[model samples]
Target: MVAREQFQVELSKLRGDIISLAHETEKLLEKSLEALYNQDIDMANDIISYDTKLDQKELKINEDAILLIARQQPVATDLRRLIIALRISSDLERMGDNAKNIAKSTIHLGEEHGLTIHPALTDMKNIALKMVDLSIKAFEYEDITLARKLSELDDLVDSMYGEIIREMLEETATNPQKIQHIMQMAFSARYIERFADHTTNIGESILYLVKGETLNLNE
Candidate 1:
C-alpha cells in the first residue's frame, strides 16, 4: 500500500511537469508568431534561442517519466496516462521546434522585402494564434467544449492558407521575381497552419485525459 501511494505521487509529479512543459512551449509559439506579424526580427531571434531551453525541459521530462515507469511499472490505466503524457510532451516540443523554424523564415522574409502583408493573411495569422491559445486553455482547464470549438477556428486558418497559396501561385506567374519571396511567406503561413494542427492535437490530448479515448481532430 505504501509503495502504491508513492507511485501515485510520482505520477502526479510527472503530470504536473508535463503540463508545465506544454505551457512553456505554447508561450514560445505565441512569441514566434507575434514576431512574424510585427516583423520584429529581434523578438523572433529570441524565440528561436529559447527553443533550446524547451528541448532541454522535454529531455528532462522524458527522463523523469521513464525513470518512474521503470521504477513503478504502472498498471494498465496508469501506464496509458503516462504514455499519453509522454506523447503530448513530444508533440509540444516538436511544436516549439516548428515555431522556431517559422521564426527563421520570418526573419528571411522580412529581410528580403518589407512585407506587404494583406489584411486577409493577418486575419489568418490571428486565428492561428487564437486556436493555439484556446487549445492551451482547454488543456489547462480540461474543457472539452473549448477544445471542440478550436476545431472550428482551425478551419478558418485552413481557408486562409488556401487563399494565400492560390494568390501566391498567381502572383508568381505574373511576376517571377516575387516567387521566392512569396514562397517564403507561403511557408510561414504553412507553419502557422501546422501550428494550429498541433493546437488541435493538444485539444485531443485533453479529450483523451477526460474520456480515455484518442481523438484525432486532423483526421
Candidate 2:
C-alpha cells in the first residue's frame, strides 16, 4: 500500500511536469509569431536557441515516466496515465520544433525588403496558439468534452491556412520580386497549421487516456 501511495505521488508529479512543458511550448509558439510579425531576428534566434531547453524538458519527462512505469508496474488507467504522459510530452516537443521552424522562417523573412506580413498568418497563429493551450488544459483536467471541441477549432485553422495559400499564390504571380518573402511567409503558415494538428493529437491522447478511444481529426 505504501508503494501504491508512492506511485500516486509520482504520477501527480509527472502530470505537473507535462503541464510545465506545455506552458513552455505555448510561450515558444507565441514568441515565434512575435518574432516574425515584428521582424525581430534576434528574438527569432533566441527562440531557435531555446529549442534545446524544450528538448531537455522532454528528456526529463521521459526519464521520470519510464522509472515510474518500471517501478510501479501500474495497471489499467494508471498505466494509461503514464503512457499518455510520454505521448503528450512528445507532442509538445514537436510543437517546440514547429515553433523553431517558424522562427527560422522569420530569419529569412527579415532579410527581404518591402514585404508586408501576411494578415491571415496572424489569424492562424492566434487560433493554433489557443488550440495548444486548450489541449493542454483538456489533458490536465481530463476533460474529454474539451478534447472533442478541439477538432472544430482545428477545422477553423485549416480554413485560415487555405486563405493564406490563396493569397500567396496570387501574390507570387503578380509580384514575382517578392516571391522569396512570400514563400517564407507560406512556410510559417504551414508551421502553424502543423502545430494545430499536433495540438489536436494531444487532444486525442487525452481522449485515449480518459475514455480509451481514438480520434482521428485529420479524417
lDDT of each residue in 120-179, candidate 2, tens digit only: 787888898888878988988999888888899999999889888998999999999888
Candidate 1 local Cα displacement, residue 92, angstroms: 0.8
TM-score of each: 0.83, 0.96
Query: Candidate 2: global Cα-lDDT?
Result: 0.89
State model 1's lDDT. Answer: 0.77
Off by over 4 Å in 2: 1-3
lDDT of 1 by residue, 38-156 (tens): 88899989988999999898888888888888888886667766776777788778888878987897788775475575456567656776776687677656688998888888777
Which stretches of model 1 miss by more than 4 angstroms?
1-3, 110-112, 141-143
Count of backbone clashes for each model?
0, 0
Pairs of residues clashing in candidate 1: none
Give all candidates' CA lDDT scores. Answer: 0.77, 0.89
